[model samples]
Target: MTKALTPGSIAPPFARYSHAVEIPAGHRLVVCSGQLGIDSQGDVPPDVEGQTRLCFANIAAILAEAGMDLSDIVRINAFVTGREHLPGYMKTRDEFTGSPPPASTLMIVSGFARPEFVVEIEVIASAP
Candidate 1:
């Protein structure tokens, strides 16, 4: 299980995530690379919501490749090109990973890996 970090007399973390994540002491960590919305055919969808969905799908696929599932994800770092599109991305994300959502970091970068990709999602999985 993962718990969201909260400062207790310490300085806050620089990153805008919910804070840090408290991973179990004995869990092995899995750091997944940033996942872009582009498909294997070398294409990125124009729609921000669609791209966000695909990006997460790619991340989940990577987890499966490592013999894990969304439940194993302790943290996530996502980058969206346009801050205005956050709601749409969040909606799609909820559809993909319902209930006890993993701890996450959402960033609004100037842009993404490709111009057409409006959103990119990355994940960190831990196994106890």
Candidate 2:
């Protein structure tokens, strides 16, 4: 199992995430590429919340392929087009993540490859 690391000496995380995670030495790691909001049908949601859901769904599928799941994720890096999307992104993220939520970083970027995409997410998962 992975251990969530949030030292008392440092400030607590701003959101539902740990500052770091300790993955056991024998675990296998899966690094997933960033996934945008588009689905198999190439449909992109216009709202940040909808798009954020799709991103996590895509990441879940990718982890499944590696014999892992969302709960196995140890770290998450997410990007949104603007600060306005922060609440939607964080809400959706909290819904998908498991207990002792993974260490995470959320950033605001100018844009994505496609203008319609409002969010993107990437994750690192580990399993024995």
Most lDDT-accurate candidate: 2
Error of 2 at 6 (Å): 0.5
Q: What C-alpha lDDT, on a 0 to 100 scale, does residue 83 get in candidate 2?
A: 94
**What is every candidate's alpha-carbon RMSD to the true fold?**
3.7, 0.6
Candidate 2 CA-lDDT value:
0.93
TM-score of each: 0.79, 0.98
Candidate 2 collision pairs: none
For residues 1-128, could you state the per-residue lDDT of candidate 1 as single tens digits? Answer: 67767667787654334456677789888899888887888877888787877787788888888788777777777888776878887778767663345667778999854577778788888877
Compute the lDDT for candidate 1: 0.75
- The lDDT for every candidate, in the order shown, is 0.75, 0.93
Q: Taking the tens digit of each residue's C-alpha lDDT, what string does model 2 give over 1-128?
A: 89999999999999999999999899999999999998999999999989988998999999999888899989999999999999989998999999899999999999999999989999999999
